[model samples]
Target chain A: MLDYKLLHALATVVECDGFERAGDVLGLSQSAVSQRIKSLEVRLGQPVLIRHPHLAPTPAGQRLLTHYQQVQLLERDLRGSLPTLDDQAPRLRIAINADSLVTWWAEAVATICQEEGLLLDLVIEDQDVGLKRLRDGDVAACLCATPQPIAGARSVALGEMHYHPLATPTYIERYFPEGPCKASFQSAPAIVFGPHDQLQHRFLAQCGYHGHFPYHLCPSSEGFVRLAAAGIGYGMMPQLQVGELMASGQLASVAPGHFLAVPLYWHFWRHSGQLIQRLTQHLSRVMT
Target chain B: MLDYKLLHALATVVECDGFERAGDVLGLSQSAVSQRIKSLEVRLGQPVLIRHPHLAPTPAGQRLLTHYQQVQLLERDLRGSLPTLDDQAPRLRIAINADSLVTWWAEAVATICQEEGLLLDLVIEDQDVGLKRLRDGDVAACLCATPQPIAGARSVALGEMHYHPLATPTYIERYFPEGPCKASFQSAPAIVFGPHDQLQHRFLAQCGYHGHFPYHLCPSSEGFVRLAAAGIGYGMMPQLQVGELMASGQLASVAPGHFLAVPLYWHFWRHSGQLIQRLTQHLSRVMT
Candidate 1:
């Protein structure tokens, strides 16, 4: 059987990003933390970490960390059933897209979290890649655009997030004086969420403009909307998030008929405890 | 002189996270993109990237990237002077902490961005580490807690962000019925931003607590406030961000007459062009 104490040391080292910080977190000496890692490596008969350029876990280390997290979940389940074991509130580590977190997620999950005495460790990732957090065992559950679940996990459709190509009226007048067309799109600046965000590119393609365009990359969801509302750039604004701005006449759709509806899914391990099950149900009921 | 075309290929590959996407962005075939990378490596007489585990630049490659970014900044200055050269707006990549981004940054820079026809590429990083982005040449400027400037850079104090240990009324009633003390803090949950965030820890230490305490990690600035207001956990919240919540009776300080003031600094290259100069003037004027 594998030693959980050693696994915990590995997890803490990776989490803290160095042996010194891991020691601070674990209340162990720096050399002691290093010894624990070495012991784990010897027991496994393989090196678990790459320590040269930066402290990154090898594939073997990642698998062990994942296993440790799963075991932690099971232990939390046991603790839930036995109240005398520990009175500490349970923590649910979840990977959620920034759009959802900014829009409906907090309001939807707030009640359940409060009532259940649960704490949250939220990882904000792009919808396109949020599922990777689940696959890598960095999170217990994830809300992502992908519908397919990895092995041992189940995915439930939460609903769709509709995005429209939106810009301020003055911005439209300035950039698209002749109305949005191929030539206009080539010159007009767009607001992209990040390098991995393809919403703008896809929206431009839908408008029959498949050409290089200049864009401002704002990683924050709130910042993205602020940049658009400030007339800095046009971008794909989610209907759920931009309702207030749209209603205030601060933003208008550049493309009248075209919209992108991305379906969101909640992915969680099938055997996850009551908390995951409850959250999944809550998300589906509220979002759908 | 180094070939700028090769450097552009390198930057795009790093930005896109793969050669295939970089090719699409660059309007080149996948093999052609790969060939460009090879040519650059041959010219340098060393491997620029480690492609196995993930595509990451070597230290030498990083220096080249930094040089390329600096050159681009200089070129943008030249284009600003010669308007007919290119009508494209200049892009300024900046690293900013989430608290500033959520509280004052968007409003402060919105007018300048709109008027100057400048585009922002904002990277959200913790204030403690934001200077590293500036040092690595990933950003033109950065807002961080560090007052010390690197070589060729100037650091100016923007203002102070005061953080108070806050919690919802009901949460305080449940967790700290006898008022906040070391024993209560040991049992009561706290909301932390992430591993690197030390605000909560500092606040706890100030409150005369040094033992281990449980915390829920929430990375989003807006979400962190929401979590605290929802009665999930107590946290160190910025006064700028929680004034409305406090006014509404949703949040209140757990510890009276205690707060952490993190001084904000704006760090930028001393030799940057007109746009940076204007921004620096605007920030110093408004923030102070």
Candidate 2:
């Protein structure tokens, strides 16, 4: 049988970036932490981490970490059946992108997590990176953009999030009075979510404007909408978010009938309990 | 002089994560991209990147990438000085946190970027992380929590962001009817921005609750506030944002006399021009 303390020590060191800090967290001496990792390495017959530049797990260490997390989760479930553990509400950890957190997620789960007396530990990152956290067992489930499933995980399509290129009427009048063309699109300022955001680029690419054009990055999803509505710059906004602005004429669709749809998927561990089931059911109801 | 094309290739490879994708970006064969990197590495006499896990630059490569980015920015500025380039307004890139972006930044710069016909590129991250972007020359300036000045950069204090431990009256009654105590605090669900968020922890520590208690992660600052206001969980929120809700009794300070104050600073490149200076002045005026 593998010693869980060694596995915990390894994962903590990788997360903390070094043995010294991990020792502080684990309440052990730095040398003690090192010894534990060494013991684990001896048993596994593989070096589990890279020591230079930064402390990161090797593929073998990653596999062990994943196994350790799964076992811990299962143990929590097992504890739930004991009368003494009944008072401790099971906490559910999830990874999700920032946009979803603001748009609909908080409102969706506000009741469930509260009413059920369940705790939630959310890890927020970009959609792609969020899945990496899930695969590494940092989170039990993830709402990701891609549909690809990891080992021992199941994925469900959450439907496409449709994005429309939109701008204020005044913005359109100032920049694209003659309607969007190569020159107009090139010269006009645009709004982007972040550096990794490719929606604006993809939209412009479809318009045959592939050059690096100027843009204003507003990282807040709601703030992006507000900026676009205030006539700062044109941006791609989800259809659900832009509906009111479109009706009010605060935002006009730049490309009518053309939309970029990003399909999102919900990925979760196959052997989940009441908490994950409830979360999945709630997300399916609200997201769809 | 160093060939900028190779520097660009190196930076692109790091950003794109592989030679194959970097080749696709530069419209070169994968082998050719690999050869260019190898040549550059030989000339530098140091390996610029780590080959495993993911393609990330070593410290040496990061230095080179930073230098290349600075050179590119300088060239863009130089290009703008020509009479023929006068019509093309200079684009100013900045890094800021999401809280500032949504709170006041988008509104504050909306007029300047639009009326001045200047483009603004805003990169958002946590305050400390944003400063890293400024140091790496990804942005011209950054608003950071730390007042520490980077090499060749000037920094000014921007005032403090005060946070109060808050919850809805109904929530307080349900979770801590008597008042916030160690037991009540541990049992109550808390809301947090992300893993890096420690405002809630500090507040709880002040209240004598230091153990690993339950928390619900709401990544968006606004969403965090909304969840707290809706009785989902108590959270630390800025005083400016909670005023109206507090007045209406929709939210109340859990620990009335306690608050966490985070001091902010504006940091900019020492050798900045009209755009950066104007932005610095504007933020100084508004943030204070």
Candidate 3:
């Protein structure tokens, strides 16, 4: 029989699409990620990935991932459940993105505790990272960014987290010397939240700029908003993600009507625990 | 950390409802059935059953049984698949009641082969026994008598298998002998398919007859019909099951319009391979 722990490791590696990144997400070493995938392939006697095109999972890999996703959710639900029903509240663990957790998720968890008498634990990470936690047996549910759900989680398009390019007035006046680059400046530098995410690059690429930004790597969604607000550089910020800052004019929209829309998606473990249902019901209310 | 396998065994036992009968249905010794359940509770660190009131599974046991049912279907689908995709015909495994296997299931399988290039491994047994086979991982799909589906399987009401209590006209004339004793004579000696099944008994029990019938266990559906034709005993035979014998006047309806109707249900692996889909589709046509 194949080692289950190795399968879990391989699953995380595929989700992250890079050995080092997957290791970072799963709290393992790069060598450990590589070794686990290697061991899993040796055990299943099949190549589970072609390992290109940004790490597409092979059909066999997809099948195993699907099963793994399902089993992981069930196990999480079981763990979160009260053992055979008791007087005490069940421990409810939820995986959620930094944006939602700091925004409206706390209210949702509070409602559940007050109404249903649930004990809650929250994991606040990036949307993409929250999914990794859900997959790695860390939490019962998560708020994700992508519409396409990670293998086993059931996803609903909560709503898009709309973004508009913004910069401080001084920074725009100094750098652009123009409101927003008219017809795409191929040579302009920019700031971005994280290393792997290319949202800013993609937006610029749409206008023919192919160069990377002198990036800030502000990991948290709130930190990214703060970095953009301080006018370190022109960057993309979600409407809800940076709503108050934009309204206060600490950040100004550089591109008046040209903000690239990054649609946000909420994914939770498929019926894991009562707390997840409570969160999703609440998130759905504000997300739309 | 409980023996998940015991949940499986308990599902099997509860599905069949008797240790010895469940053993025969599962192809295990009665002692093996007891041992499997004992080991399951030991693993679970809890007693799963109270051994009374029709042997109910504990709440945890019930939940695990539901999961086991889903797992079994997924496992069957996985096993039915070939090592690699090829243009060749795929083997399909199905468990069907003897009456259905003999009457309509063959034509349905033939139709599936013609349309989908399927190779079938047909399992013939009683409907109750077929469900047990499904529970034990014997077949990828089954045509069962019960309307309720096994945990992971999908079910459809395939209408009724109209049965007319049949025997040589001479047997009714001799047994009844005179008037005013019709219901009394109907509950007399009967032909049951096998020691494991109680279809005939159910019919009598429903009619409020608490007495046992002096019986013959013919085992095969065809054999049961033939013995009924020759006047060995009265038995409920499906219209498709004894249609030709009745046409030839070799078997005449002993009860005529008063015979009981036994409904047949289609149960297939919820995540079945291509063949199960094709076969169940055709069965809806013939059995309906």
Candidate 4:
């Protein structure tokens, strides 16, 4: 057995690069840090340091420090996820993309946990980046498309969301008047869910029309769908999100057969974790 | 969040059934368990039980209880493995099978932890059932062939271990100079590692024989290997356990070109953790 408390002190010293500075972080005297390190080596029954005026960890000590870092990360995640299990008040923290948050995704997240009694800390950003919150120790888990296992984390696939080239029936009729999709879409003004979204470009590439379109950058997802429904321009939208508008004739998909599709995936830490798994379960059922 | 103390108390109640018996086990008044359950539901904002003369948990309550049981098992395992990290000489608790303890496996386990500065407590039982020690909160983890994933646990395939029929070359020559493996084997005693071991049965079945072997059960892994080495009787042994003996010609494998390969998997609670992974790393390198 080794003294991790002393090892932690040693790590702090290596991190601070001075005994006095390490003592300041550890709230110990410089002499105490040095004494602790000495005692740790004795207890290990092995020399674990090559002490110098400028503090540095030995090979064995460095290995112990790496273990210490992993333990620290695990402890932080446990602390964040188990606040209520202890004397502390419970809080629910979630990391999700802005597009999903602004769309119907929040409604799904809210429905699952609201009645269960917890305050949620919603971390909203782009889907591509928001998922890093889980890895960076900012949140317990996240929803992402990258899909590869995150070291110790697990992922479940949520099915594809089809996004067809959509526009208002009148916008299609009046703008072209050459009937639906007859006039090339290469010159149509398109609505974007966000500046980062490339669905329109992808659709045009598939249509073999490499020409660019004038874009309306409506960052909000629901707003983009509304702009298309209001007959402003053509945009790709998921059927689940726009079926009612399509039914009411406010929006008519342009060449409904040609659609863009993106598959979604949910990733989380693999544990007997009720919260993350339950949330993933509900979202997968509804999305798929 | 669920109250762990309450769930444990409820489990105690279910195990005992009567409130007085449950109280005795938990060292609380019967009234305390009842009050605890009431408060737990209020705190969680969810009903977990409909108390009667004997308690029966609701569906949500059962799920919560199961999670608590997993937490309890991991906590116990942590306690056992934690002492190993302390050079101050805290009580060391280790989980192992009777067969391994009797065999060279115990020696390996002892030697591996000896220089590491651990105060050891080794609990021994049959490998097939020693896992109950882990699940019931007795030991940290054990070497088990159980392939099913236990709640809160993970499994890794350690690879196949080939067990061949072996005996002292002298004993084989003296007992039956000419092979009448089926007829002579029926009369010759077989050395069994433990009561539940299937190697002898499978071996005999291969020779078109049935019924039980005239058995001498040595319930220790190292002892089983040593017994066969001493010309005690013919028995099946793992290649890793007997590979050195075979190389030295101290033990000759009777079923030379034929053997049974059993793929052993390592299972341990996720929280009990990488200890099992470390063991698997060492065992796989040699076992294969």
- Predicted structure with the largest DockQ when compared to the true one: 1
When sorted by TM-score, best at the front, the candidate numbers are: 1, 2, 3, 4
lDDT, residue A152, model 2: 84
Q: Give the C-alpha miss distance for residue B283 in model 1, angstroms.
A: 2.2
lDDT of 4 by residue, B76-168 (tens): 456666866432322223454433332334234333333332223344444456565555544445555667756776666556567788888
For model 1, the local distance difference test gives 0.84
Second chain only: TM-score per model?
A: 0.95, 0.80, 0.65, 0.58
lDDT of model 4 at position A42: 82
Q: What is candidate 3's lDDT per residue for A201-244, written digit by digit as tens? A: 66776656654233333334543454445444467776765677
Off by over 4 Å in 1: A52-54, A81-90, A285-288, B52-54
Q: Which tens-of-lDDT digit does each residue in A120-167 have in candidate 4?
A: 444444555546555544455666556675777787877656788888
Q: Of the true interface contacts, what fraction does each candidate have? A: 0.56, 0.59, 0.00, 0.00
TM-scores, each model vs. reference = 0.93, 0.86, 0.36, 0.35
* Predicted structure 4, TM vs. truth: 0.35
Query: How many collisions per candidate?
Result: 0, 0, 2, 8
Q: Pick the winner on lDDT between candidates 1 and 4.
A: 1
On TM-score, the candidate that comes out on top is 1
Local accuracy of candidate 1 as per-residue lDDT tens digits, B30-108: 8999999999999999987767445777767777777887787778778878878866677788999988878788678
